[model samples]
Target: MKYLFAILHKLRPLFPQSLVNYGYHFPKAYLAARLYGNPGADLEIIGVTGTDGKTTTSTLIYHILKTARKKVALISTVDAKIGRKNLSTGLHVTSPNPFTLQALLRRMRSQKIRYVVLEVTSHGLDQFRIYPLHPVIAVLTNITHEHLDYHRTMGAYMTAKLRLFKSAKHAVVNKDLPLFGEINARLPKVMFSTYSLHESSQLKPDNIKYFQDHTTFTLGNTFYSIPLTGEYNLYNVLAAISTALLLHVHQSDIKRALMSFKGVKGRLESIENKRGLHTYVDFAHTPGALRAVLTNLRSLKKPAEQLIVIFGAALWVVSLVVYGKRLLSNLIVLKLST
Candidate 1:
């Protein structure tokens, strides 16, 4: 299948982009689904997509549903799961090709998994890799500058992300994003709910507090706390919570799940050394994500402590370098390594 894709790439110059997408990739995805018995049709799928926080948000939604005793599975950039069994993604890509994705979904369907929380990507949406699954709930964490190398412009990138909502029955959105209005306009028929720090949102956090090891906030009159840090993480929590509520999960169950939830790996993950120094492992590649992680770390630092950061690149390395330099100049002791 991969070889076939490679051969198709050679014909890129002879065909238009839409033709290549519809003729080659779309059919490939559909064939993969047919071969896998159309597993996505047997399960309720939820797709989460954004420039940042897709993994964490998807994981959070998975955890919440699992804790509530729903048979749930998750597929994210970092890992994939079926019931209690977990596996590393093994692929560098956030969303794998059609054959791989449909096969995984088929396995989950065989296990009678009721729900799947998937981290959808723009590349996957544009390529029609997720064409077999129409999500019951689609979440947009937020859209920002990302993947411009392939999409070529911010508008195109956003259009790719918005594709998820087109087939979705309901949507959970970040009210704080400028794109929210446009997304709402586009999905006028889709049931929409929003979360934000602002008072006007349907679900807003109150009494927010961030500490070294955990953060606390209130949604309505119920207080909830999570072991994850960062104000941005609070948004992630809100996103998950809103989805749970939309699914009709009990508020008590939501609180219980969140309270017991540990943070996602590689997203603001903390490591401690014997000398009591702390190191963090994070998959924050975008400017907004990098800034959020650093800002959270700064708040957690003692007055005299020094914060050192290490970064690696993924989609937009050059843009990350430029943004990192500008954002971290006064925030951390800057160190660059090639």
Candidate 2:
């Protein structure tokens, strides 16, 4: 399948972009999944897609389902798991090509896996990479400025995300984001639930507290805590918990699973050292993600402590440029105050 795509890519210059997309890419992917025995139809699949937190949210959902004694699998940017077997993706892409994805799902189905949690990306949705598999539950963490380089506009980017909801039986959305209204308006045909920091949301958090090593918050009268610090993480937890509730997992089990989750790597991962200086490594690439991570780190530091940040630029150069200037200006202010 990949060989065919490679050959087509070489001839891509001779064809229109739409022709390559609809004529070649979509058909090739769909047929590959069909050849794989249509594995997606054998299990309940949960797809989590958004600008940020897809990996973390998917991982958390997988963990919770596993803790509930369900035979489950996880496919995320960090790794893919089927029971005891773990495979590193070895690539930066969140969603793999259709051939790779379908093959993995076939393996899981053969092992009698009951549920599969997948991290869906806008690119995958737009390209029809996750073809032919309708999700049982779809989750949207939140939409922000991202992937404009490919989609060309926020409306197009959002439309790509909305594709997931269309095929899903149920959806869990972040009510705190302004996009919630738009998403809700389009979900009349799909059963959906919402979570938020606001009091009116179906799943809302209260009595939030952040510590250097962990965060604690209350969902209803039940207290939950995780060893991941930051308000953004709190939102990720909300999404996971909401999904679990919709799946009929008990509250006690949800709390237990959350307490045991160490967290996903490269997402605000902390490093220890002999010196007292604190450091963290995070995969926050978008402007919204960068701001969230930086704000969380800043809140963790003492007034006299220096907060240093290093970033890598790859895709989304426009967002990086805008964030870079703003970050530098803020750093200068911090320096002047010190």
The model with the greatest TM-score is 2
Estimate, for each residue in 160-202, the C-alpha lDDT of model 1 and write its tens digit.
9989988898899999998777888878889989999974889
lDDT of 2: 0.85
TM-scores for every candidate against the unseen true structure? 0.90, 0.92
Local accuracy by lDDT, each model: 0.84, 0.85
What tens digits encode model 2's per-residue C-alpha lDDT throughout 1-338?
Answer: 56877898799769865677788879978887888988999989999999988999999999999999989999999989998988875588788888889999999999999889999999888878888889999999999877665676889889999899897988999889987888899778988788888747888888999988899988778988898889888889999998999899999889999999988888888788999777788887666777787778788878889777665453334565456545653554344332
TM-score of 2: 0.92
Q: In angstroms, how far off is 250's CA in candidate 2? A: 1.0
Q: List the candidate 2 regions with Cα displacement exceeding 4 Å.
A: 1-4, 13-16, 314-338
